[model samples]
Target: MSNADLPSHCDVLVVGAGPAGAACALWLARAGVDVVLVDQHDFPRDKVCGDGLIPDAHHALRRLGVYDEVMAAAEASRHVACIGPRGGRIDVPGTVAVLPRRELDDIVCRAAVRAGAKLRTPWRFEAAVVEGDVVVGARLKQGDVVRETRARWVVLATGAVPQALQAADMCKRRTPSGIALRGYVKNDAMVGRIKALEVVWHKSLTPGYGWIFPAPGGRFNIGVGIAHSHPARDGEPAKMKDVNLRKVFEAFCAHYEPARELMRTGTLEGDLKGAPLRCSLAGARYSRPGLLVTGEAAGSTYSFTGEGIGKAYETGLLAAETLLAAPGGVPAGTADDVRTRYEAALAALQPRFDLYERANRVNAHPWLADLLIWRARKSERLLRRMAGVLEETSNPGNLVSVRGIVRVLFPGA
Candidate 1:
């Protein structure tokens, strides 16, 4: 559909119909708000991702009322195995699942539509419509035609890609914090053997890790990630452009015996695909006058594990809540209140992000990872606690607490 055929105004215009946008639109629509969700791609489109959903992501899906659907359609696993440097491995028990973005995103977007949100697919967001420092709406491109849709509030859920943000002059920094590559492989041998989500840490891939997640139909989602700001062996800063992620992934698969064995009977589904991961480590601005940024656009991905789905869903929910609570659907005078509440909500969620950022630093040290993994293997208490963190039931900071550290240092204690 062309922009000319679309509504000229909406109560809220959400750009990028991914997890964050869909969740926000779903919540707002359920609250009787007039919301319109737009995306650059059509349904069933594939995004480069690890496909693994932790307990946090599952909870978000449940909030969106699609948990049962996802669970039924995706592969479930209760084990998470971490392979540290020198092959030191630790197995933690947790509830996790994997569903390809092609399916997962479609499910969530459909849920939003069903909840009364208008969805505009293949509608590319071109720029924000600002009326003297206040974002009033957005300009969307449909084919060769550009249309203007006005709204009291505009939410930016454009994940990773900075083009829209750049066009709006809202992007503060141009450099991405991390990069990752993923691909799918079909292997009959992996059906039973790979019952758990596995993450491997190699010395060569410091400040990054590789993962193998069990996908449906005996397939596997395998990938690797690295921080662009990773420190080099000579203690110099590493350049992201200089690093070859594909080559690194190939080397990682070849170096690990388990990865090699998994790929033995495996055939890649397609070419390897990659994307940039914008970690919310340095704290990106999440709101302005009338526009609010959510998801990876606001850098909500965890620095250590590169997990964004749950966080994106969270930011979406927060955005919806903020607008819903506003008087008369976010009036021009109340724009500052919206920005303040969103920023405060983001700050309240900062503790977890801070812990993960610290953990990322520790993960860069192979010796520390090896020691922690080796210790976690021998201590069921430590293992269970670690599992709790993955399940989002326990605080990650607890692992490094005085008592928690003592327990890890003295397993029998």
Candidate 2:
């Protein structure tokens, strides 16, 4: 059958089966919309990430009705340890689950499927078919077959890959400011000692940090992400991944007591994959006409830690809610009401991660790390402030005074 002959055109078409796309599809399906989710790859696909789910991410999973299932299916980590230079360190007691991106994506995609959404795996978006001023649908390629599918609304959930929605002509090529490298490790040697997550903060890796997150099935995901302040310092003209991630990991592992033991028997597999980690958004607006952007495409990913899944899920849920609540029923031809309501909900409901983003930038400074760690050792108040900052708490403003006190103690920092 030809593209037009396809009997099942969905009410909403979601591109990219990442967290943003899957969450959006799941939310819409739960709302009784004919949602079709498409991804370039099939289920259990891997994405480069630290692989630790923060509390906010946990809450988002709960909203999608698969939190327990995810936790059960994946390896779980409960505490976070922060490593610093000068042998200064701190451990925050909290529950941050660890699941490989492949498994996590499958869990979310399955949730959407259970909610009555159709999932088209191995289908990639080629281009959008525009009708006048609105996006009508997309031209897709499935292996050797090419098809044009039409939908009422198109949700762009593709992360970092801006080519599909290039028709919008909105994405600006900002300076390549930050660089990230990550990979996975597998071993059974240190199964009992590996915590949920570990972060190493050091001058060797400035503006960014290294992370070790243990997953289920005796596998660990570990990598380092660094932000290059000056373009002159850009490692090289080569791909971003070429920056010696193994050297960085080895250096940290040699010093870290736990990692040193974990590395003895574990195999560090795969090359270091790198990408531009945008510290600031090119544009934070969510929707335009018949098109809507969710998750990293809209720059919803938090800069402090590369944690976007939770925020992406919330954005997807909001988008679905807005579409369902629009006056005169959901818009059938364009994406107007959905865009407006989604933007409003995002601003009002989700906490802005900008502050932590700024703090991460400042963390590049050596003295700042020393001062914070010193103060944390001296005062539980300072430790709480540190916790508040990273956790992105609603009452984080409450810790500003303690932060000020620490600032006064180390004026130069």
lDDT of 2: 0.69
**Global lDDT for candidate 1?**
0.82
**Candidate 2 residues 1-413, lDDT tens each?**
01123224668888888888888899888878888888878777778766778888898898889999999977776577766766676776566888888788888888898998888867778887789877777788877888877888888887765665464544554334455677767887767777648787777666667777888878887777765432443654323434565576677677666666666777877775766544334343467667777776766666666666777777677667777787755545336666677777766744465554555543466455565566677777666666665566533333233556446486455
After superposing all C-alphas onto the true structure, candidate 1 shows an RMSD in angstroms of 2.9
> Clash number for model 1?
0
User: Distance (Å) between predicted and true CA of 369, model 1?
Assistant: 2.0
CA lDDT, every model vs. true structure: 0.82, 0.69
Report backbone clashes per prediction.
Answer: 0, 0
- TM-score on alpha carbons, each prediction: 0.93, 0.86
Per-residue alpha-carbon lDDT of model 1 for 1-413, expressed as tens digits?
11225678988999988889999999999988888898888786899888889988988998889999999999999888888878988878877899999999999988888999888878888888988998899999988888899999999999887787787677866667888988899998778988899988887777688899999998899888986453334744434457788787987888787677877778989988989888863424688888999988888898888889889998899999988877666443399888888889988988888777766754476566676787887877667778877876666665655665676788667
Error of 2 at 301 (Å): 1.6
